[model samples]
Target: MNAGTTAERVYDSLKRTLANGSFAPGARLEPARLAQELSSSATPIRDALNRLAGERLIEMRPSDGFHIPRLNEIGLRDLYRWNEVLARTALRMSRKSEPTGGHHIAPIDAADLFGFIAASSGSGEIVSQVASANARLAYVRHVESSIIEDTADEIGDIATAFWQRSISTRMLIQQYHKSRLAIVPTIIELIFQDTQTIR
Candidate 1:
């Protein structure tokens, strides 16, 4: 394959592996092993690792190797808060800019969100899937990070519950148009503080 294609393949494979929890936090990412597993070459693997490192998904240690960056509880909370803001903004933009030629623009459902993410198999699909998956993965990463930090057990379940409730609240806001946008950040802060306290 071409260099670009190979790089894309490497990037996608690594992203999927990271997303699915295959590469745990602080796990070393050996370039040779990655190239072998992905059936690519070191060049493409290096390119992919660089890209991931740029995104803070992985870190390049001095005199060491690439490892998944570990997030503390505060970092996890900040990540989740960012995700919530971005997801809400994306949803609002999607709703406002939907095509008008009798094209139905439905609010994103949980199943649709999950399926869109599951079907993402390449870098091309990343932009389309990132909003949802980032929102979801933020929670997952928060829980896992919390566990590693010894801040909490069963934090993933709490994050999942918060996400479900947020989805419902979004639906209600769309249907009723009664909720203020200011409430979103408040809700996020409340949930974050509550989770921290519960831990």
Candidate 2:
């Protein structure tokens, strides 16, 4: 394989691991070990790790190597809130426009959405795939009308800006996963809420 393909593989492998929770928050990423695991040289591993660091998925330390970044409770809440608003806004905008002939909005399955986003973004095939994933997830939540408890209703108007255009179905899927990352903390909080309510 070419260098570019190798780098892409390395990047995809790392991202998949992160998304699947195989590597927990603050887990160390040893370049040597990663290279061995991926059957690649350290160069590509370093490159992939660096890219992940830039995405805020991993932390880079001068002397301590790389670790996954942790999302605190407050940060996680904000993430979920931001996505909810953005997604709703995008859905509203999509409704306003006339659907072109042959244009279809399919009901997106959760597993498919995750797989699409992982492949699209990790492969570096298209930048918009990330945004598309976000939209799809939002659509799912909106369709279910499940109010994400404990999230702020004060969604900023900026979300509407992202919704004004006709984003590809693929990008909508990507956006879904990206937004899912934000509300991870809320999911944990919900478990506690359930426990308290039950008692």
Candidate 3:
């Protein structure tokens, strides 16, 4: 077991840890240490780090090594803003003859819901970046779960419209995204506070 494991397997495991925020932003991702923890060798860990870097979840420094991307106000805003644009494009594209039904959606989970929309965007880059950003936002979403829950209805309506092919309601999707901007300011402040306490 010394040679230890597959790169793809290591990548998946490390990605889960990163997505769950087990490793805070800017935390060094030393392959040797990670390999030791995973009961493997550094080779797979290095491979995993490269894959994570491709998704923008980790940064590879020139002289240093891999580290999680640092979270900040600018980065947080960029994540939401980009998610909005990408998700909007995806929803519009994924829009076909919507299924007819009164199926109810679960309460709002911005990270997850928007991740779904972005997944349909038909663009690999868009999907990858959005997923990475959502992973970063998962921790914040957990902390501010209540403040964001108010979006449940609006988001549900948007999802319902998408499902039912209701043109009238479908147009409301843009408004849903625009309305989300209002919370960005507060989110910015919260992320700033949260990152400050990280170290």
Candidate with best TM-score: 3
- The residue-by-residue lDDT of candidate 1 on 142-198, one tens digit each, is 433432342222333322323343455344323211222323344445445645564
Residue 35 in model 2: shift from native, Å? 0.9
Candidate with better TM-score, 1 vs 3: 3
Which is the winner by lDDT between candidate 1 and candidate 3?
3
Better of 1 and 2 by TM-score: 1
**Poorest 10 consecutive residues of model 1 by lDDT?**
173-182
What TM value does model 3 have?
0.72
- Report the lDDT tens digits of candidate 2 across residue range 1-199: 9999999999998877665445434457889999999999999999998987877667898899998654455655554555444444334334343332234333243423333323322334232343333332332333222444322221211222223333544255345435556555555455345445544
> Per-residue alpha-carbon lDDT of model 3 for 30-124, expressed as tens digits?
88888888776777888888877887888999989998787666676676676667666776766343222234455356665666566555567
User: Candidate 1: where is the Cα deviation over 4 Å?
Assistant: 96-168, 171-199
lDDT of 3 at 114: 65
